[model samples]
Target: MTGTDGLVVGEEVPEFSAPLVAPDADREERSLSELLSDGPVLFCFYTADFSPDCIEEWCSFRDFDWFASTSDVQVVGISKSRSWIHQQFIDYLDLQFPLFSDRDLTIAEAFDVRYRVFGLFERSKRSCFLIDEDRTVRYKWVGQHWLDPTRDVPPVTEIFEGVRNELGAPETETFGFDAAMTD
Candidate 1:
């Protein structure tokens, strides 16, 4: 399917590589297979690095308590921003995940989430994909419209719950604070 239609659940995501800025500020090319090698992955696609919505979405992922508690899943971000911009953004937010630089929107196009904003500038629609070890998409979420004032990031808690139900809980919950403490 074309990028406008976006990928669907059960579709196998093709392996691709892109330049990325790691949390430690290293810039290098990384492939999807390398990421999947660790386990399942949650790919968060956004319009730009410093946009308000992008910041909010990434901060949520950075502070996601479930992420700290789970070693079975890795979360990374993709955007059209350059590697240096991604480094600054990651440092500004203290993000725990790497950010891929899809400056030409090639990766977003492959995922079918690339769109032209105001019918001019190319950008990635806010989207998320839960891809398993087999490279098959298990879950997908895309924002209704980039210009929609109400559009926001997908709910991390709900995604975490779905992952738990599908993959079962990790054997040990060594990270994150006690859930009871939040109550």
Candidate 2:
């Protein structure tokens, strides 16, 4: 499980800290390092929120509602929307995940998702990343920002079976050893 090409899979993921707003919190700041403390995380980036495709994509993640129990994976959607805007988006859509505001594109750039839209408009191309417990981006996909994300989360296998396999973390609670606390 390692980052490849421009994305690092086995190395430490680039760290960027910025203000983030959860469904209930205000303009609170959360860093990449902080988010990785608990375990793995899935980051879904798009042009913006409230767009038909974007909203539908979020709804799908919310509907799955399985990351909480299935793995250490926590889903976070990143976009140029303001924290307040994210709050409304989350509230209106009743998303059960966190949405991070990357208005400055710092986080987006760190993940190499930030770029000019159509070579003119500034925005993050629709992209998805699978970060391992060590914050390494083990999987990534960018392009087709307009595709129907309502269909599934990228790296679909992880969405269905959890990231333990992708990250090479053995199943322990049920398979035998504790997945976490192991080297």
Candidate 3:
């Protein structure tokens, strides 16, 4: 099926940033400018941290930890959840990735992913965007819990292969990364 770029292949990513959902006392902020400034970025937008679908999606990624290790991609889970709540969810689920709290819905708005889901309450849609090295969206996917995140998108292995084919790898390297090296 056709993806979010509409009909275009390469287009500038929608700009965005918001407060982090991590529960650390120091706290921090997330900026699309800052994130894409270094290199490729993958933004995974979920309704909330603890929802059944969100939980399953995160667990799928967690189960395949290698997605992060071998690819030149930066995976971030985004939601409108509060930082403290996000911390609890992460801790309870033992998620190793970083999640941002777009409490104000600024980032989601910019990305055009925030909207009213239940006809009464506005929530984040389950969407994913692949921003390339130049901060342009290369691919996009969005789902409203009709499918399973565990099977819908092949594990990080396929993602790595697709990305490597889309973007050239170093000449000396024989393969993409096999595990995520994050902080």
User: Per-prediction RMSD in angstroms?
Assistant: 2.8, 6.3, 5.5
State in Å the error of residue 166, model 3: 2.8
Tens digits of lDDT, candidate 2, 1-183: 111123555655688887777776566889888888877788888667788778776776665555434455677888898888888898999876788889888777777656664456666656677787677777666554253322333543344344555756444432222344333
Across 114-154, the per-residue lDDT of candidate 1 in tens digits comes to 87766777778888888999999888777785474125677
The CA lDDT of each predicted structure is 0.80, 0.67, 0.64
Give the TM-score of each candidate.
Answer: 0.88, 0.76, 0.74
- Candidate 3 lDDT tens digits, 43-120: 777777677767888887777654455446667788888888888888888776678898876666666666664445
Model 2 / residue 183 / CA error / Å: 26
- The ten-residue window of minimal lDDT in model 1 covers 174-183
Q: Provide the lDDT at 91 for model 1.
A: 93
The CA root-mean-square deviation of candidate 3, after full C-alpha superposition on the true structure, stands at 5.5
Judged by lDDT, which candidate is best? 1
lDDT of 2 at 116: 60
Error of 3 at 69 (Å): 1.2
Comparison by TM-score, 1 against 2, better one: 1
What does the lDDT come to for candidate 1? Answer: 0.80
Q: Give the C-alpha miss distance for residue 147 in model 2, angstroms.
A: 10
